[model samples]
Target: MTESSLFKRTAAELAEAVAAGEVSAVEVTGAHLDRIAAVDDAETGVHAFLHVNREQALAAAGEVDAKRAAGEQLGPLAGVPLALKDVITTADMPTTAGSKILEGWQPPYDATITRRMREAGIIILGKTNMDEFAMGSSTENSAFGPTRNPWDLDRIPGGSGGGSSAALASFQAPLAIGTDTGGSIRQPAAVTGTVGVKPTYGGVSRYGLIACASSLDQAGPCARTVLDAALLHSVIGGYDPLDATSIQQPVPDVVAAARRGADGDLSGMRIGVVKELGGEGYQAGVERRFGEAVEVLGKLGAEVVEVSCPHFDYALPAYYLILPSEVSSNLARFDAMRYGLRVGDDGSRSAEEVMNATRGAGFGAEAKRRIILGTYALSSGYYDAYYGQAQKVRTLVTRDFEAAFEQVDVLVSPTTPTTAFPIGEKVDDPLAMYKNDLCTIPSNLAGNASASFPCGLAEEDGMPVGLHVMAPVLADDRLYRIGAALEQALVSEWGGPLLDKVPELETA
Candidate 1:
């Protein structure tokens, strides 16, 4: 492959070249870094990266090259360049989780995924932007600024994980890590024309990831190709002693399943369509594209059946309550007493005042809003009416997923209800903006495995809409298999990657 083209090659292709000694690890790392440098402008502005650790990256590349020269065997992902979301801790780079309160704070330890990537010889490119503490549905809430969509800079890249998706779509990196609390990975991937996966709750270790909503948070891989996601997932997922919630089982062979589906025709794969996920609330273009996706899956020998999760109607409200309640609790540790920037601590002031002053100054408005909303919900008189009831609703929503998965090998829906909206459109309306995650939030709530891949461009708007494939909890490989099958079928049918439709970037 051409030098200019190698950086854009699929993860599998890159792995082959690395294994065969056709490309040096340092060369590949440099190429990706050059690409990142090439288009990092206000116009092409894929503001995906927060703090890039070029020194560490180059150092890692050198070690990989030395290993190759010594004839030492390497893992499948050796020499790959990967992006880390700010939410995930890294020893070399400061982990901000896209909030000013935690700015310039580097952890003494690496996140489990970060540590795993290093062990597999993958170079860390940088930390990506996200919603402040992953609280918003779009990256617009990022304290560092929003990551513009790779497809159309005028619009948003999906939130929380938007930075990772933008980086992959822009060819800045082949593989990246992103978190999904409420469609942060999948929705952003959909808008940017890349692949994003949310493995089952305990599939990927959450040891060092900053908590947004503990029960709902998960870290997963994001990439341009399904197999690339699988590779990264394999590297990062497994049990960790640090996270009590981590399930210590071997993560199924996600890459193997993806590769198999890449070649295997989608025969006998039963797909259940969630009636609640796509319909009246969906944009016409989204619906049209989803319909085409259904047709494509059907033609590929997949049996498409309609399934209903009636409790889905309550999902949005329930998630808002539960998430804020958790956030209110989780963020309490960031008071002036410890960590990051502390603004207001005077010797005369009481502890509570210092906390109030510190939090009031450090937190952004959206974060403050959620904290207040959560406090109100968790208040003694309202706890039963709001937070407690939301927990019950979560159980119902999860049961619906269990029942649906029993009926089909995988469940399908539009990754988002609409294509990417203009940057500021929903920034002011939290509720309306939160609705963008309607199709994706349930998966996080239920702790199931889900993958989002581009289906086709939206007909009315010409923007891309994604098709989501979700599987049972701990059956992450199933999502990858189904996603890879659909990805290969659609890419082959369309004759190439979906970003071919994206407007040309006005590189600096």
Candidate 2:
């Protein structure tokens, strides 16, 4: 382990070193803060973080060191620093969700996951940026400006969760928390050469997550390696009474599965390749890398076969309708009458007028577009024609997943159709932007566990390509098992992690 560049180490390694008294938590935290200050320049930096809680982070790290000094038993991830997606609320930090509506708003209470992280002694570094209300495929929708892909500064980092991915890729943080609603987590991971998971919908509580689409939204761990992600997943996932939708069951033993696979064996695992997610529209390089990944799985002793999920073709259209409908409702709480930004509130103005003004000023174009589309879809007679039909389609997609799961333990596909596109390339093209989620949305509709891990870099643009693996609702361990196995194989083949090939950025 190289102590000089602590930022390059994995979360698990950092935790181990800290727990062994090889290094103090405050030292680790301060080193990361210093790195952030050096590289996260306003003009050339990745701009992954929206806020950096230097004071609080250092204090938390010091507390961990004190606890260890007192001979207290610390958790597995104790002293490992993490970046929180702005979509998750925090009592100590501001959560904007990349929207002006909630800018500078700090909640009085911590989210369930936030509390869990604290209990595990994981220092919350600060909030990373995201799409406005978690609505867009790219972080371009963020009012805070976009996060640049570390692979290529001119390109996108992937969205709603791009900041988290970007932060990991740039070595600003070893771990991050991301919310996946129509691929916010996985898509970013796919493009940035990192690992991201979208656990079963209720696997992690949504109590403090700002709603995007209630039924589709899920929070999961993002890290550089499968085992690190699994470690973070165990720390954050479990039942929460505050979240009515939270699963009242034991969290999967992802850490054990990851360790098993790290030994590089997947002999009895049955992996399915989804028929509908590939071909025509997918970039050739993405397909090539995905094909190589499948071959690696076969050599690792896993059975790989193609399975059709016909209804997956309709996932995007259905998701667009259902998500906007939910967004219209969930985002309604941002009216000027409550917390956050308020506009046109002079005595002469009516509350309704003030609300209209506030919303008009606070929302970005993409958000307004979705709100209008959602409002129209849920309108009197059209509800049955659009929103109602979309729900039926959602059921069909779920059924497709259920049917496919019976034939295989896990399913595989390219996490995204292509690698990261240049920033501003699709900002004005809504359809092109929406297409990015085609490979990732079905799992959200089905409420299953899905993850993206670096397969290899696409030859065309030299950007990362992710191999997506999905498993049934409580079978999250399956994702880590395969991911860890594949990662080990790829690492052995390449002589290092995929991010090792990334071009070095000139940090300040």
Candidate 3:
């Protein structure tokens, strides 16, 4: 395990090595930091991270080393480096939520998951960039700038968690945290050839996560492998009394499930092919790759069948309504009187005027667009017609999932309709951008567990395609099972992880 190759090891492998004294925690952390320094700031680099907590990360790693040296037992992910999305609050670092409004705002406390990661001895490398307020499909809406796909520098990494996905794909970190309001986690993973999981809503505590759509927002693991994501998932998931909506159930044994799935046997499992999630608009290569993945599932002895979730057609529209309506209410806290950015507050303008100026200047275009859309949907006159109706549609989508699950252990689809699209291609086309979440939104709407696993590269552009898996609310282990099976088959076929094909980034 030479230092130069340390960044390429999975979190599981690194943790095992560190625990066995094969490598010091500082050495592991330093390898990642060195990797970040070498490639992250290059002229055409990934630019995945918004901030790198060099001193804090190294110090945390040192503490882990001390604990290990003292013969104390450490968590499974101890000494593993992780990239956290900017939306999650970190007291020591800024929690900007990728919007200029919260830029440079230091949080008062760590997000529950953040604290959990520290407790597990996971070193927080830095905050990754995202779409402002987690409102866009591509990271182009990030106030700082877009996160370029590591697959092709000119392409968009899936957003609002693009930074995390990019970090994994570029080998800057072995693990990362991402929030999926719609498809923020899964879509990015699909585009970048990484693994992302959106745990069941309320499965992971959201105490310090900056609100997106409170009902829909979920923070989950992002990694290069199914097992690695599951390992991270186990550490951050469980009940948190601080979060009112936190589930009161024990976290599922996802790591064990992932390990079990690696045997490549799904003899008794039943899988469903989502009829609504693919077809007419789906790219040829995506559909082809998805069909092949489904075939692989069949070869693994799983019963594959097509299931119809008819209401899924309306998921995009309903999601836009519900998400924005919630966004309108949640974002109201950013008024000029409190923390974050302030404008025209030099003791002259009225409070309302100050708030207007601050938000106008602070929020990026997409954030403003969603806020207005949400406000309009929730407005007195349109509340019943827009927001209320959308809620009804949401219920139907949940019913669709319920009905589908009764027939299958898990549902599958192409995570995104297409591969990574070129940046600037759809920034001005909001509707086109929103379409990216078409397949992923149904799960968020229903608050079920979902994830994206790298299946293989699309022939059209030679970019990655993700196999999306949706499981019942508490049946998150099912997702990892399916993902692990696919991952094992795919890795064997590709001769390695799909990300191994990514072109090497030039070091600074």
TM-score of each: 0.97, 0.99, 0.99
lDDT per residue as tens, model 1, 1-508 = 5666887787777867887889977888888887788775543477778888887898998898889889999898899898889999988889998888888998999888888899899988888888899888778888888888877788888887888888888888899898998888999889888899999998889989999989999999998888889988988889888889898799999988998888746787889999888768799988888888888878878899999999998999999999999999999989867578776566788888877887888789799999999999999999999999999999999999889878998989999998999999999998789898898988888998998988888877788889998898888998787778888888888898887666766655
lDDT of 2 by residue, 308-377 (tens): 9999999999999999999999899998776999998889999999999999999999999999999999
Per-residue lDDT, model 1, residue 178, is: 88
C-alpha RMSD values across all candidates = 1.4, 0.9, 0.9
Worst 10 residues of 1 by lDDT: 38-47
- Model 3 agreement with the true structure over 1-508: per-residue lDDT tens digits: 7876899999999999999999999999999999999877624688899899999999999999999999999999999999999999999999899989988999999989999999999999999989998888888898888899999999999999999999999999999999999999999999999999999999999999999999999999999999999999999999999999999999899999999999999999999999988879999999999999999999999999999999999999999999988998999999977699999887888998999999999988888888999989989999999999999999999999999999999999999999999999999999999999999999999999999999889898999999999999999999999899989998999898898899988888
Cα deviation of 65, candidate 3, in Å: 0.5
lDDT of 3 at 376: 97
